[model samples]
Target: MADELDWQLCRSFLAVLDEGSLSGAARALGLTQPTIGRHIEALEQALATPLFVRSPQGLVPTEAALEIRPHAEAMRAAAASLRRAISGAEGGARGTVRLTASEVVGAEVLPPMLARLRERHPGISLELVLSNRTQDLLKRESDIAIRMIRPTQSALLSRKVGVTTLGLHAHRDYLARHGTPRSLDELDGHVLIGFDKESPSIQTLRAMGFQMGREAFALRTDSDLAQLALIRAGAGIGVCQVGVARREETLVHVLPEDFVYSLDLWVVMHENLQTSERMRLVYDHLATELKAYALTSRR
Candidate 1:
């Protein structure tokens, strides 16, 4: 056993974990099956542990492999960030900037703005990761993030775009059939779409007096995009961004005065990224575009 370990072996291990077979890992990494096998064996030997065990389903990671997976993932993220930083240094704004945002915003709000960025700055390459789970900025999991809440991490640069205003909304057809609720109490009689799993954001809504539970919703899903789609499809009334609802003529704002909610939106990046021209260009564009979008929600 040696004090130093090879990062390449960890990469191969991750590929095998992701792809589920040595041949698949090989194809993914553009190497032969034997090379992947060797890397896994070498890594196991270096650590004096069996990383994976043979199973009917192919290869299954052993406990040891599972234990080390997060560290390896962190290494991968750091390596990618470093590569992007180096690439951006050579050319002005012609390098990759990986950005992360919530599923709804990424799917509904960001596409047009990103298209504009691509058209204006063809040299800049972008990678967008859409997830409800927050990507860690300190670990460099993403170069930039569009966050609903203000970032609390120190050593980070952030610009508050504006508050994203959410209100109860339904398709005009749904409202025509079910009849619009005149007040919050009247909501009990209408079909409602909402979250299946309660989250912090949901808790915030609950705190604001919209007490919601799984039983309360006629349709339930954790995905924000799915809820929005359901609202658009005229399934039932659901909470939606006022700005997004304004885009669709069919969607009717349910209750603006009595049932309005908002979350602070911010563009966040590592403080170190301020030195990179590419990072700044993308960050500024996101801040400006998102600010305008949030403003519309206010109206």
Candidate 2:
């Protein structure tokens, strides 16, 4: 085994990990499947370890693969930055900047900021990946991330973007039909829509003295949008961000004003791409936009 390895092989390995299959990686890289396979085979052979275990669902990465994923991602970001630097020198700062964020933020917050970026830098392309799951930034999964929770990894650079207030809310029609409860104890008699027990949001509610066990829920979903939709459909009461709830005429706050929770939002970037112009621009724009929601009066 040699310490020296081909950069292209590492790129292919990253593409496979991101796409979850050789065929997907081949399509993404615009290379033949056999070529992609050869790269992975060479990578495994060079490292003298199997990087992934084949599964019916897809290729599941082994421990060795997981260990090297962050490094491979760093290399990819470096390569992208190098390309951008050369291109910017020739034609000014211009290229695609990819961002990953939770669905709520993507839907409620990013549009205006992204519009501003397009207006200011039309040459820069933006890719927004919306999901509840946290993307692996070290793997170059996205150039930037807007997350609800602060990232624990030391390799990434993170900034507090803003904070959002959350509280129990119910549709006007539902509350009219079932009647609103005056206190937390009365919640047991009503149908509740809530996150799963493991969700941090639910845990926070629990800590705040809200009973959020499974027994209280008539409906539940992992997706923020799904939960909001159910709430809109008059399914039951559930917790929601004030920014989102404020926009809805039918949704009304259920609890007293003092009974609210706050969550700090963060804008994060891979250390490797911290100097990239497009990424920096997007990060700055998001930080500015989120400030509006941070103030208590805004909520």
Candidate 3:
């Protein structure tokens, strides 16, 4: 096996790659530009190859950088994991756990779980990045990830938290005003609210004979919270997960048992973090909390 490279240098390389320039990376790391330069130089010397090429576009990574990116990321995650393990061994649950998830998971799923985590581990801090785009766990962009779709990356570990049930929902007042359509064919005249872009749930709804197209959205927002708020305000009718829609009494199931879809939720972490006490605690707690809503009955 190749001799282990300098971890500090690898970390600097990752920082440079993430920030897109040495100066930016230096600012992020709170180090001088010269120090950052030395780190990169040492890393290249140790590996005996050029990892990046400097250009007008900033530091462009070479093929070697691309090849070793995953390993370098694993090293950084492992280091964070080690810090958590050491802290726990010292009898303190401390360190930052970075988590990434979609807007729905961030707004509807993780808040309660985070509350419980705060109560249980007072010293642990959480950094949550909520976006529709998938954050790379293997690249150390996040310590843990909550995703609707199961991840297939070989270097990451994943567990199915539970499945979420989705159904057509509308405000009680909206249904009273517009009247509920009994058949999918009757949906033509009824205004529908849905995700703007292609999503699994949207595709599922389309497959189920719902007429969802560019003209379907009477109101649309990227944030699930915003969408739910609009639905609660009786802006339009749309599909929502049972767990999210059930929380609001004003939002009632439209199709009820006639139309429903299910999607699996997965809690994923880099394999390097499996032994990390902080990451483990957060991951396990989220999984347990999510499992409670797995097979919820529509109200």
Pick by TM-score: 1 or 3, better one: 1
Where's the lowest-lDDT run of ten residues in candidate 1? Answer: 1-10
Off by over 4 Å in 2: 1-3, 14-21, 51-70, 77-93, 131-162, 197-211, 266-281, 295-299
How far residue 210's Cα lies from its native spot in candidate 3, in Å, is 6.8
Query: What is each predicted model's overall lDDT from 0 to 1?
Result: 0.91, 0.81, 0.80
Task: Using lDDT, give the best candidate's number.
Answer: 1
lDDT for position 128 in model 2: 88
Q: Mind giving the per-residue lDDT tens digits that candidate 3 earns over 1-299?
A: 24757888888999999998999999999998899999999888888899899899899999999999989888887787566456556444677788888787787767888998999999898888888777777667788888877788999889997788777888989889999889776666677776667766556556657565755676766566677777888888877888888778888887676676777888999897777677788888888887886755233
lDDT of 2 by residue, 10-79 (tens): 9999999999999999999999999999999999999999999999999999999999998887888778
Error of 2 at 190 (Å): 2.4
TM-score of 3: 0.69
**Rank order (by lDDT, best first):** 1, 2, 3
State which candidate, 1 or 3, has the greater lDDT: 1
Q: Which candidate is the best by TM-score?
A: 1
Better of 1 and 2 by TM-score: 1
Worst ten in a row by lDDT for model 3: 83-92
Misplaced by over 4 Å in model 1 are 1-3, 207-209
